[model samples]
Target chain A: MKNKKMAPIGVFDSGVGGLTVAREISRQLPYENIVYFGDTARVPYGSKSQNTIIRFSEQIIRFLRTKQVKAIVIACNTASALALDAVKDEFDLPIIGVVIPGARAAVEATTNGKVGVVGTEATVQSGMYTKVIQGMNPKIEVIEKACPLFVPLVEEGFKEHIVTREIIEYYLESMRNTDIDAMILGCTHYPLLRSKIREYMGDKIQIVNPAYETAMDLKRLLEEEEMANDETTEHHSEYSFYVSDAAEKFRKFANTVMPFDVPTTNVVNIEEY
Target chain B: MKNKKMAPIGVFDSGVGGLTVAREISRQLPYENIVYFGDTARVPYGSKSQNTIIRFSEQIIRFLRTKQVKAIVIACNTASALALDAVKDEFDLPIIGVVIPGARAAVEATTNGKVGVVGTEATVQSGMYTKVIQGMNPKIEVIEKACPLFVPLVEEGFKEHIVTREIIEYYLESMRNTDIDAMILGCTHYPLLRSKIREYMGDKIQIVNPAYETAMDLKRLLEEEEMANDETTEHHSEYSFYVSDAAEKFRKFANTVMPFDVPTTNVVNIEEY
Candidate 1:
């Protein structure tokens, strides 16, 4: 508990999209310190190949290891889908990914056994969610759709815009006929459009946000492994944000999405790693 | 002429977006051989920093140099805006960028001495068009708007979708009341949405595509420097496409946008350069 309390937990993503996950972790575990890295220089890892994604994830993991993190979270779904297997065994720390927790959540929440997943092209192509959910329960059916435009729409700050609704409808048109009792927001950016997605999918469908479940899973793991910070420290937990490019721009964007003020944002020369 | 005829003209962009420029170049200079490199692995250069952009441009330039190109065209707006000056003097060859040519055309086409420029956030933020336009003709009024979402919208193949129309209208809402007679499609991707943009802006507004002008500029430069392939050869002019990631994906996307069939597409290890 003492060693874990002092060592910060690392979180990383392709860009500011993973802040949603980090935000949840901060809320769920107030005592834990967080060290976050966003690969803002080369973002939207969803479009890149598996080799590139793995290379990038390894670099970020190596950087985080230098920060002395007790645990690491691959906050980007694309990275988790494509890079988890390559890095999970290499590191000594408990490394968690968004796919498994999200898949488990969808499996638990689905009453009709039919669950839907929407993510980037790479995430959908990797079929990580479907694979994990099917592994958890062989009978559960997974319907995965690649929502390529959602990330851009979200980045453009069109979460509640009318065009966003239209795009959502267009992407989810096929799912309308299919009976999906629970839908998993497979991408970190998708959670921002929760209301619009919910509005489009109707009241009966449950939108499962993996970020929430991921935070819960981390909490459970920490407790189980006796890594939970049981000490009541006088100092407030700190959050450090690092990005590969334009720290100020990332800081400004983070302020808009994050509930708390981002005070310590720095630029990291990721290539050196 | 014989020496230049054998040496292919080089063109590069951050991703498939630059295929628009390559398409125009192929149309305007059908006889000239072309070598195009798309940095698909680290695309959307508009979001990256100036230093990183310059580094990428230099690497691509080095790679193109190995191909023995007579001249190089910076097909990407962001790269032209950020890296052109840095690399132009470093290399002995005559290098051209899209910004200057587009600005020149905009200034020439405008009757009201008022021009509008729509591009990526980084391109618009760089103020390259405004600077070049004002440098060419100080009397010409340049109104610059960063249409950040256009690239993603185009990549998502929403060029003719209703939501795309809505998005175009939303982005151009501020420009609707302006007295600008000419608007520069500053980014290569913007030209793909030319018809939709023209429809939204009405017939009175002349859309100035930089890719067209850039190709023309390259043609003129080749002629002026006696680098034109004046010698008629029996062999057909070849086109080679290289991407930092998935060559097949780039080839497929290029087929949809390009008029000619892309015959030789290969993957490049850009970082090694």
Candidate 2:
């Protein structure tokens, strides 16, 4: 009901990995202010139950709303797959998730009509990517693998470690042998491990990073809804971050991922919400 | 407080890993009724901040206290390292943690003055094992390495996987060249990966599991305090399990580890506490 064109865009993930998505949004929409929430305390939502993920997503969305966000992006793929539909209908504002954008990208990139998706167990179990990709192109066949160890491996900062490569080999064994020409890095953290993934999956299998597609989707949506920042405003975008637990590690990680200095974010005891 | 001679002994960890300690208690003190709480929802307290771990530990302890537990064991090593000192004086009843017991075992097993301790970053950073082992014998040198990847790998159920072996090699590289005779698996989850560790570390280095020592310590405390379960009652020990997340996977895991059929446990939304 109220004008939200001037309000900040809300982006969130289970932890710091969503910074990849946040970074893309910042790069694409340089003038738009952003409010990012990382649920650092109870992170890696990929393995958690749908009910718990929904509850956490609701609490985070509610928290983001208080920041007067114009629109919200569920940057984490597991949350996007499991929690997005539940919250999108419940909330009033424009809400977009990484899954659909990722699915679209994978659908568009694949020439062999077969695609591989790597995500958490919850995301794979939901079968959302397969369904979404098939919906866009009925002829496309989707192969989904749950790489449960990838998130923890990435979060552990094992980007170039041999263990990571071994893990990549283990997780992508099925995907590697398949005829799928495109693989979706379905979890937000996977982007951070992109090089390792690219190295293992090889050059033939196009890796679809939903963060870039999700940013483009957001850009299009803002333009379609006439909600882009006013040209005359000369907006100097201010980025704010919030998390459920201690901010030290997340802040440090963000400083590496985000272009700007990671600000002193407040720790919200999200359970209270 | 009401006389609790027949009451259950409370035990808790970040997740189902504490079942090792609980299983140990059941084996050693067969007559004791044990109430165990595994914070499955917000697990892997190893990397969490001290304040957050303390708060979660307090909540679990309070939840356990409601069941009229006579003595409580901080089955999680990170919690023992970070939260025990903060909660021990605050609570009225006797509270014991895994660190001292594990340290004692490591010290006793070590033929050489140098002892190795492997655990989560928070646990290693706390320097609890070093301090406790040194407190017993000033001549002993304690080498602590934080294996941040172990808990997640264990939770992912990759006990004998190649990645697990590679990760084990990566984590134990520092300790492998050292003269330390005994390595303490300081975190509860480490015991699950014991076989792989033994293979990697070899038979020359004695491995210490805190679960067994912690149970022994509890047995000693019960007898010393004159609060052992009453012999005249003809007590049948009942084990009750409670976790914060979905119980199916945990229930399956428990059925495998636990001696008795783990009773249908309720999922408690622990944050409310």
Candidate 3:
């Protein structure tokens, strides 16, 4: 219900995975309204072409802009890697992506020079994390792997299953073989499988969730722009959930995984935008 | 070049998995001109809603109809399960789907009356195979499980990897525990993982690939209707490949897993049709 120009922050991802980013935003900025959109119909942007990813992101951003949100977050790693640059200049508002913030966090978290990043095929292939990390600190050793199966594994609610652990081992084999002190859970969905990934990678390897870092980045930008919601005025945070398709399915998923209660969700025909 | 009314069979799937069905048709009817379309852009229709899947199937069917395809095969199991009935009457052509043929094959192959089926979530939920099989023989029992990760696993080309075998064990544990003598690889993408599935299920269970059955079903319809392309003529069979996106990627995949060579491929903006 908070429609004041500075009251809402727009968050969007290819699918429900974006909720992780939104969850962090809610935790960090409780009084800020969140307008979240999930492209559920054509999700798993990890395997899609860059053009399609950009097209979808632009459509979602267009839809979000109509809501008069103060700023936007590209919550998905694949979308951040492939579509962020393309949509950045076009959208008139302040927009932040997960890639740079995540890279910065990984750089800060690592003790040893060895760092690891795992994400969808498109995100890993984009090399955004490696480029940003190595650019920030030239001596850091970056190990990257594309864990394309992680989304499906998490979506299937197999996060703690032995199957997931084996899969984690399978995907993290290259990362595990190294002496990486910090690992970035590059994809938004990867955070859901953090327990299995941690169990497989062992406690020595620090796990970094970019959703947390992206939320922190949003908080900083909001404060700098003087848009932070005044939390002391007895104003409660409001959440709006939208999906391209399968509203009920998204609602069920959100209710289970999200920290806040998801009472209802609406469907948006994202293509029209 | 075989556009002479009834010279070509239109075959389509969500993506390359339908290539398995295309491969089967190519193997069974070596002389039939095959027009294959892969909806690579909006692929893995397996997890999508019925309405979306039906809409996608109709678009692809309309596209294939333009090529003068006499008979059309819905190679993708999810589309065939959810969309075939919706599109069958409107299309004015002899349309065949994989579900019925697959059910028939499973019924014939089952000795213990307990038949197992593995497919994407949507296909399993549709229960088309169960309905068709039970309608044919009421005495038989059907045990169905949705293996949502199998598509991603195969798409990642981890068909024979230890991870795949372990994941297969995770999914098929229910079926493997049953007295089911035969199992249907209900999703077209599945045949690519045949060896691993067979290895996991052991040699006792008869593995039924619906693509092969669907191909045989098409063979029957073509012969019955006198639409079979004559091989004895100076005509050599021609194969044309089209995808909604990623022509080069589809070409590469077809070249690797197809029964024949894939020299070239074309991209189609399926939405425009």
TM-score of the A-chain for all models: 0.97, 0.97, 0.96
Residue-by-residue lDDT tens digits, candidate 2, B1-273: 225777899999888888999999999999889888988888778878888999999999899989999999999999999999989988998899999999999889998888999999999999999999999999999999999998888888788777888889988988999988999999888888899999989889999999999999999999898888765466688788898987887888899889889758778888877
When superposed on Cα atoms, how far off is each prediction in RMSD?
A: 2.0, 1.8, 2.5
Candidate 3: segments with Cα more than 4 A from true spot: A1-7, B1-7, B224-226
Tens digits of per-residue lDDT, candidate 3, A58-113, equal 88999998877889999999999998888988988889999999999999999989
lDDT for each residue of candidate 3 in B1-273, tens digit (9 for 90 to 100): 234533689999888888888888889988888899998887778888898888788888899989888899999889888989999888898999999999999999998898999999999999988998999999999999999988988888777677787788888987888889999999988887888889889999999988778888998988787788766568678889999777888899899877668999988878667
In terms of lDDT, the poorest run of 10 residues in model 2 chain B is B229-238
Residue A191, candidate 2: alpha-carbon lDDT:
83
Tens-digit lDDT string for candidate 1 (A1-273): 588666888999999989999999989998888999999988989888998899889989999999999999999999999999889988888999999999999999999999999999999999889999999999999999999999988887788789988999899999977999999999999988888888889999989999999999999988888887765569588789999988888999899877789876999878678
Q: What's the C-alpha lDDT at position A144 in model 2?
A: 95
Please give the ranking of all candidate structures by DockQ, highest first, separated by commas. 2, 1, 3
lDDT of 1 by residue, B118-210 (tens): 998898889988999999999998999998889888888788789889988899988978989999998998888889999899999989988
Order of the predicted models by TM-score, top scorer first:
2, 1, 3
In Å, candidate 1's interface RMSD is: 1.1
Would you list the clashing residue pairs of candidate 3? none
- 2 or 3, greater by TM-score: 2
Instruction: Report DockQ per prediction, comma-separated.
Output: 0.74, 0.74, 0.59
